[model samples]
Target: MIYEICVDSVAGVRAAKEAGAHRAELCANLLEGGTTPSLGLIRAARRVTGIGIHVIIRPRGGDFLFDDDEYAIMQTDIAAARQEGADGVVIGLLTAEGDVDAERTRALIALARPLSVTFHRAFDMARDPFAALETLISLGVDRILTSGQEASVLEGLPLISELIKRAGERIIIMPGGGITPRNAGRIVQAAHPKETHFAALTAEPGGMRFRRDHVFMGGELRPPEFDRLVTSGQIIRTVMKNTTG
Candidate 1:
């Protein structure tokens, strides 16, 4: 089975490669559920990892609907990702009515030619998964990263399996979200998907020698300032072993 690691940094890309992941879905601010990475970050990741790099094209977190300006930003990001040598890009766009933004999605797909494209977890936020699946297939999207419209893949196993069967060879249905080494094997066995996506992250103490407490840089709902989350190669290796063994 092909394994794709959701990573937020160059270090994460390196870790994913070392651990035998088939690809890295590179993003920034994964805590915000992933956003478009900077061009510099994309270039750095390409330099550091030989594995496939699929940069996420989300401008921000929260909803998949985009304003005209935000849509334009996404267009620019897709071009930047391609310029930076990314092997692929992940994107999602939805209409106010909660359907796939087919027109805009088609435009971006055309622009991202020669590079594989994955419709990110925004598929989970779609109002109708089956309709969206058909729309994406019509647009020629390569794959979709979804959790079956649920909070986790395990909870959405039944739908995931159905989606895979319905998709046939028209598109790839990749299960992602809340997957761990413990449950990876079970999800694989149940869904029988061709690929899986997840992040193997761990909190590591930041390189701060001084003490600075109570000053929230990210404003209240924030992670610890003295600690950072990073992908762990060992964790990825363990998950791979458990998944494919």
Candidate 2:
């Protein structure tokens, strides 16, 4: 099994590699459910790590729904990521009515051609998961990143299992959200996924402290969002070794 760790910063990507992650999904703002990283950060990550770096192609936060200009931006970003030597790209698109925008999605996939495309968690918001899966498979998507339509994968295990059964090895069903070393073992045993995604980050905002009264500029925690049970390289490798062994 492969583990895809979400890294919002160049530092996080290096830390993920030290933790033995097979791949890193590079993004700018994990707090907004991940967005595309800048060329500088992407190049910095590439220079520092050998792990596969799959960049998120989201232009902004808020919703997976996109307009014409936003789609154009995404296409341009995909080309940039490919040229920058990204191992893969993560993206998704939904209609204003909350359904898969098949034509637009297909076009994006074409732009990301030859580079692996992961239909991000926007898959969870689809009106119909089964039909949507069919559309993605028909569009020749490589994989899907989803929490099985629930707020968390643990809560959505039944649907995840059902999805795995129905998928029948056609496309990858990668479970994400609320997954951790503690629960990852159970999730893997239940869903039998070939891959999983998580952000192993420690809530140590104080260590990078400048001044508590430095409110002149309101700081935002970028990338590798959220606190977790295990944030150390040791914890990540130990859990992965135990689970995949």
Best TM-score goes to which candidate? 1
Model 1 lDDT at residue 13? 92
> For candidate 1, which ten residues in a row score worst on lDDT?
211-220
lDDT of 2: 0.84
Q: Give residue 213's error in model 1 in angstroms.
A: 1.1
Q: What's the TM-score of each model vs. the native?
A: 0.98, 0.90
Candidate 1: where are CA atoms >4 Å away? none
Model 1 RMSD, rounded to 1 decimal: 0.8
**lDDT of candidate 1 over 1-245, digit per residue (tens):** 89999999989999999988999999988888999988889988999756999999999999999999999999999899898899999999999999999999999999999999999999998999999999999999999999989999999999999999999999999999999989988999899999999999999999989967967789668889999999999889988898787
- Which one wins on lDDT? 1
**How high is the CA lDDT of each candidate model?**
0.93, 0.84
Q: What is candidate 2's lDDT per residue for 84-199, written digit by digit as tens?
A: 89989999899877788899888888888889989999999999999989999999888899999999999988988888788887999998898877888888888888888888
